[model samples]
Target: MTRLTETARGVYVIAATPFTDSGEIDFDSCDRMVDFYLDAGATGLTVLGIMGEAPKLTTDESSTIVARILKRVNGRVPVVVGASAPGFAQMQDLTRRVMDAGAAGVMVAPPGSLRTDDQIVTYYTQVAEFLGDTPFVVQDFPLTTGVQMAVPALARIFNSLPTAVCLKHEDWPGLAKITALRKDGTLNRRISILCGNGGVFLPEEMERGADGAMTGFAYPEMMVSVVEHHAKGDMERARDLFDAYLPLARMEQQPGAGLAIRKYIMFRRGIIASPAQRKPGANLDALSRAEIDTLMARLDRRLKELA
Candidate 1:
């Protein structure tokens, strides 16, 4: 079993799940992607996260993705595998398999089709218990989860779990609340807060005392650059990079839009096979592609200017 104290920090890239032309899981591409991000200097990787299309993947598929990542990483850095199952039993089972597959930790969101804050807390608590000694990251993405964890609820949940290592705070205000919790001595000093919202507010969160960010868009370098800059005390440069890439970031946030845009950029960078996603989540139509091309061209020119 991976050590419980194998904590990660800085800009970790949550990778986009690669699919083969035949619509099967592309294990080879997954391995390459893992190596690509690690060499780019990601603090770690969170596979099967929202960017990995966790909701759309089957149970076996999720397990396979985590296994591929672990094999590629070889424990060089911690890997947080997503185990957000709609039901408790399935979530627990996935968590066990991921841990068995060599994931350093598991990141889980509140259960699907379940609303109440109490239910969310209870679900996570039980899931944490099932995992025993593994580290758990409470994923808070209000946009996808349809429910947000209030400060008090979060406090209660954190207070209850010894294995809860971090909070993937996706909500800006919620991140603020998390910072507040730490400041006020409510949150344990050991627990880290990883910024989630696609690195959009990373600079701000870092300034406000967030530990790091988890964004899939920064596959190759810019993500590493941002964190490295910040770590070196170049807050101005880091924030500038974050704001300058806001358009690209927004494009990545649009549902049915995020992966496609990232994949195209990766293709332009010569990373992926063709940026061809399987049916139902492929690139935008002709007009949408035209607009993306225009934006991408502008961004590429601007990036060159900065270089």
Candidate 2:
């Protein structure tokens, strides 16, 4: 069994997958990104998440990344790997593979292109059984999963898998549903909620009772600062830091920009290798590039001022 430390509720960085010019998974750069998040004091590193381009990556690549991250992390914190796919069998196999490769936990979503609630539950049920009580995070990405995770479904799945530990809460309107579950005593007592929506609404969600956030393109210090300050009862300072970084979040989160833009910002921040994306169609035009550059420069200067 992969030993899992209790990951503190904070901004866990979705470590972006870097690619070589020849279109290969860059393990060297992937390690660097993991280290960056660790040094930033992230609760953990979520590899192959949406921000990590989970959908586009191949199964081999996903398992390889999980294995490498597991080795690099060395049980310091939870390493959650994505095992989502369209087929239940594939996801089950992927989950088992990643676990065998030493992942501390796995995060999965409803199979892509399948909207049936029964199918979603069945898929998760099968994956959970195969994984044999391993901790899992239910990743709610309605924008892509096509199935909104209603409260009933969440309850049913969690009831079935007693070991389900976390929820990667992404469904917006449904976010309230989760909070309702917690408020009304419907969810399991051990289940912790993590925000996976790019940290845009994290403060609001935190106020609403979320455990922590899973953000991509995170500068660990500021991310941790916001959460820690709030935990320290300094809501004003937390809000101030949140506002200061809002522009950078908006710039890097443009639809197609996803992980590519995250990599670019990390490069601009001098934390990674080239910002080259593994696949095409992520090419940013001059306007987007200049916008990112300007925003990053301003954000960097602000960081210095804050320091």
Candidate 3:
């Protein structure tokens, strides 16, 4: 398998775990989803992310899904799995399993318990030690993790850990952080910076030196186009594509309902067999669904105009 590296760029889509209405893992849908992502031009696929409902899956289910996706991908692109767990042992075990099963690398998010910069740096340093040469992504998502990582602290984590190869930057209002990281002397090495706010800020993030987006905003083709246009130095074209999907992207970014909205969009687009979530997770109601359908219709019409 070609492993993910600090130079990895373009979109590494945070994939949704497909489930049947009966709440069973939908393996068929998983295959279709993989094909859809690659067809839409994803550079890689990231499974079992926080939005992918990683916490709800059993250990066996996680492995099975990753293996299935890996087999389908057949090394067309890198596949990064989330290995974030409360204990280092669980994280290490998952990392080993996924990497051995052909995953490119794993992503680790700091525990909310971390309180100080030293603690944050120490946590990732230990993570690198536990990972033992396996490349990993630093998921710096303070909005969800509740662990704030200052730029310097992040630099320390990246500089001190040779195995840490990417930063899944999800800090709100974090454009400056991207600039700081890209600045000379911020770190002794370069790493991929993939922003993850559902690609709503992707145009700006790309301008601020983000390699691309590592997000699940349903319409991944939009993110792919934005990144490609920006890379070609076409700011107006990038923003135009981004603006076409901004409403749905913004709605899909809502704190609690984002995943539901994304699943609904994916299902309506026929990327998944069902829009079901596991127990304790709700699908969108009729009104919510109607609102999203309206936004999607508007997006389709706008995309045609842009084309």
Candidate 4:
């Protein structure tokens, strides 16, 4: 399999699931979206993520989407599938299906019920057993998962599980965690640390030793450029580019309405044909749409100035 490892860096775009106006999975748009991400300089692709609207899809739909994406990617870059489920049996089954379909790896977030450090470690230990050699990413975004994994607990997970290869670190204001993990002797093994708070904290996270970003922002080129500039030690250039996109990024990250905003942008950009989400998802109103249009226009102007 195409396994992810410590050396993996640069933007691994969290993909959005495309749907028709009638709520059917838009397979055609899926192909277009994959191509768009690669052309925008994504080093890898992560699908079925929180923002990918994974839970909104049925098991058959999930498998079909992953299969479609893997075929489109065709090994150009690694594809990581989110395999987090309430039960290990479901998680394992999903992992096997995706891996068999040629996914590079899987990502798992702690269930919302996990509270203490021990509980987090125990959960991952079970995850490692269930996965059985499939490389996985530890998604530590307490704001959404409601499970706070402290540094020591994470250290133990990294030390114990050989297959845990990366982190989608999205702990809000969690720059300190990145600093702590990168400190010498903190983790038994080195793993790629990718920040994922909508790339809002990417600049600080990189400064604190994060490899890059693995988040969903409408304009992934912004993330790609920021990570590249940071790697070249051009902090000023990185910050300039990040700042140019920050307004739109922040707007696209609204808790209940973020995905709608993102899909609207993608549709406006022609990456996807429609801005539709499955049932139970909100669609942007005229006011929200107008605001996004304004931000995007400003983003264009700022990018031109930077150039």
User: Which candidate leads the pack in lDDT?
Assistant: 3
Q: Cα lDDT of all candidates, in order?
A: 0.75, 0.74, 0.93, 0.92
- Which order, best to worst by lDDT? 3, 4, 1, 2
Give per-residue CA lDDT, model 3, range 173-201, as digits (tens): 89999999999999999899998989989
Model 1 regions lying over 4 Å from their true place: 1-7, 112-116, 172-175, 218-220
Output the worst ten-in-a-row residue range by lDDT, candidate 1.
Answer: 1-10
Clashes of each: 0, 0, 0, 0
Candidate 2 lDDT, tens digit per residue, 1-307?
4443334478767778777767777788878877778888887778888777777777887888888888888877777787777666787788788778777777877766556667767867886786676788888878766777777777778767765777788876555766675766575554677876677776777777777877675565666777788788887888888777889776765677666677777777767667777666377678877888888788778867766
Q: Once superposed on the true structure, which residue ranges of model 2 sit more than 4 Å away at CA?
A: 1-8, 113-119, 305-307
Provide the lDDT at 111 for model 2.
61
TM-score of each: 0.90, 0.90, 0.99, 0.99
Give the lDDT of residue 306 in candidate 3.
91
Residue 203: error of model 3 in Å? 0.6
Which residue pairs in candidate 1 have backbone atoms (N, alpha carbon, C) closer than 3 angstroms, thus clashing?
A: none
* Candidate 4 displacement at residue 232 in angstroms: 0.8
Candidate 4 regions with alpha-carbon error over 4 angstroms: none
What lDDT does candidate 4 reach at residue 204? 92
Residue 201 lDDT (model 3): 90
